[model samples]
Target: MNRFRQFMSGRYGFDQFSQGLVILSLVISLIGTLTRSNILITVSYIPFIYAIYRILSKDINKRMKENYQYTMFINTVKGKFLKGKRNVTGTKTHKYYTCPKCKTTIRVPRGKGKICITCPKCRTEFIKRT
Candidate 1:
């Protein structure tokens, strides 16, 4: 145990990006197995190998940057999905409109008859029936 600890003392270690890579590798491997595709099975080893490389890498700063970028990308995707979900859920009670000048999305209450909508971003005025 002491020898193993010493071996890993300066390693970059496992992180979220590594975990994601491992999961991706596993999924690809499973698909390859189900389809019995040699090419896919060979490709599946790429991510697993990269993950192992990351875990054993001594470049802590570079690994941290890579993990940060991966997390940022994931957060951006999640934010977009959540925003879409909120828009969908609010569709029953609100109307969404885009500003003609700035293309900003404005949400207004539903059932308002022939209302003049103002865009908060670009101060554009438009008339719409909700």
Candidate 2:
């Protein structure tokens, strides 16, 4: 245990990106196994190997940056999905529109016909039927 700790002292170790890669590898391996595909089983090693490489890498800054980017990408995807969920849930009660100038989403109450909508972010006005 002590020797392993010493060996890993300068290594980047496990992180979110590494964990994701490992999970992806396992999922691919499972699918490959179910289908009995030799090619897919071989392909599953790619992520697992890269994850091991990342875990053993000594470049801390580069590993941190990679993790940061991966997290940011995940956050953006989650945000979009949540936004879409909200829009779907609010479809009957509220109307959703994107601001032309700032590209911000504006939510307003429905049934107000031919109203001029003002963007809260950019103050741009556009007429839309509700």
Candidate 3:
């Protein structure tokens, strides 16, 4: 028992949060699978499998976080415009760009071409070369 505790403590010391997420996802997945619900299965299983792979595989966690954040950011931006809702009056249609330096996504009004922009997170300036 002591050896098992020591091994777990060492192997997953700082990974408890991720481990918990993985376990929770797995439980959801199992429930979905048992109930044979397609949507629930996809919602619960896919991310659970991915999280497990990300946690146990050779992929770096930072890279996983970046990839997840980028995907989520893109999804959020896409959802906003695709929902058939217009922005507040006086707000122009905006084009969004992800900062190469700090990964901060910025939105600028459309038709602004060949401009330089600075990222708030990294404070790095780069041309919008679009």
State the local distance difference test value for candidate 2. 0.96
Clash totals for all candidate models: 0, 0, 0
List, residue by residue over 4-120, the lDDT tens digit for candidate 3.
Answer: 665455231224445555777878878888999878767876666655655444545564565567567768978877643533432467766789978876767778679898888
The best-first sequence of candidates by lDDT reads: 2, 1, 3
Model 3: what TM-score?
0.32
- Each candidate structure's TM-score, on Cα atoms with residue i matched to residue i, is 0.85, 0.91, 0.32
Best by TM-score: 2
Score candidate 3 by lDDT: 0.66
Residue-wise C-alpha lDDT for candidate 1, range 1-130, written one tens digit per residue:
9999999999999999999999999999999999999899999999999999999999999999999999999999999898799899999999888899998889999998999999998899999999
TM-score, model 1 to reference? 0.85
- Model 2 agreement with the true structure over 5-71: per-residue lDDT tens digits: 9999999999999999999999999999999998999999999999999999999999999999999
RMSD of every candidate to native, in Å, equals 1.9, 1.4, 10.0
Which model is ahead, 2 or 3, in terms of lDDT?
A: 2
Candidate 1 Cα errors over 4 Å, as ranges: none
lDDT of 2 at 124: 98
